[model samples]
Target: MSTTTKTNHIGRKISRIRELRGMKQETLAEVMGISQQSISHIENSETLEAEKLGKVAKALGVTKEGIENFSEENVINYFNNFNDNSFSNSQGTFNANNCTFNPLEKLMEVVEENKKLYERLLKAEQEKNIYLEKLLGK
Candidate 1:
């Protein structure tokens, strides 16, 4: 018996990224000014023209290279490693730079956890502010 592995396929890569982004063919089609059928066809083909690929990349909010190099395993590995909370060495002490913690991810988690408090603070700040509307011609 022989075993074979398929290499990267541009169309499949596009479909995967689009699906991961929670987008539907209809939505992508609308944004690209093409019919949903066209989007389906594009997703099934192995190659796409550079110009058309640019349009698809723009609609999906990613660069063309991102779509071309998309790898599900790599993405899964990234998320899995990101969820790992162990930041200590064998001595059980935190690293000086906290290499295991992603600052942007932590910031986003904090923002989400305090959404209501943030909204309230913004409202209070706005209420305490004073603004005057000047007459247009005066």
Candidate 2:
């Protein structure tokens, strides 16, 4: 049997952290005052300079050490543990009555509001078109 070692690629860590934060290359670039092409280059490199790494960390809203030590497995484990704790009490009891509101009802409310807004806008546009046509006919 052979031993295997994981390679710690700084660029890959940065890319993963950026993705986890729901950030796009363009967004990070804008925050760092760099171009999207530059962000792409940084994400492809295995290593980065100290100053550049600091800037990237700041732009991503994490410490430099945080980015250096980032791991997908750790993130997954963290969220798994968080989810397990979210629905339980201190005595490890699940509470079924903890839900405050119905998600489907909230979604239906938003849809209905959007539909009303769209109908009003459509009616206004139709009235404007009718007025323009009457003027053109004169």
Candidate 3:
């Protein structure tokens, strides 16, 4: 497939991951440290950069390899099918309660929440530095 096709495939995969995790565009952007507008752009299949790809992979709890290798047709078909399901009373709306796999979404939350731990670590280091400085009369 062409590069355009690959990019579109990745974009649709992102949308699925977001919907699976029940994350809004704004929330995903916050987790990825990018603007929601950027997420919007990427999901719409406009264009994507390596850095944005990394951020999306991190926030979506998917590996770069997985994201890169995802099938465009499957991703797009899923979105199209999902939309169709929403309108079809027989298929109904999206729900994982009936599915077999543990949702990938939890990973997204856990990884993003690690930021809090990082902050705590930084504070502890700062406090340790202060104590050491006082000990040395600096």
TM-score of each: 0.59, 0.58, 0.43
Q: Please provide, for model 1 over 10-60, each residue's C-alpha lDDT reduced to its tens digit, 9 standing for 90 to 100.
A: 989999999999999999999999999999999998999999999999999
Against the reference, the lDDT scores of all candidates come to: 0.84, 0.89, 0.75
lDDT of 2 by residue, 23-122 (tens): 9999999999989999999999999999999999999999999999789887776556565336433467464446689999999999999999999999
Pairs with steric clashes in candidate 1: none
lDDT of 2 at 111: 100
lDDT of 2: 0.89
Q: In model 3, state the lDDT of residue 70.
A: 68
Candidate 3 per-residue C-alpha lDDT over 26-72 given as tens digits, one digit per residue, 9 for 90 to 100: 99989877799988889888446787788788888888776776665
Number of clashing pairs per prediction, in order: 0, 0, 0
> Would you give me the overall lDDT of model 3?
0.75
- Which candidate leads in lDDT? 2
Task: Judge candidate 1 at residue 120 and give its lDDT.
Answer: 90
Give candidate 3 regions above 4 Å deviation.
1-8, 71-138
Q: Please give the range of 10 consecutive residues that has the lowest summed lDDT in model 3.
A: 82-91
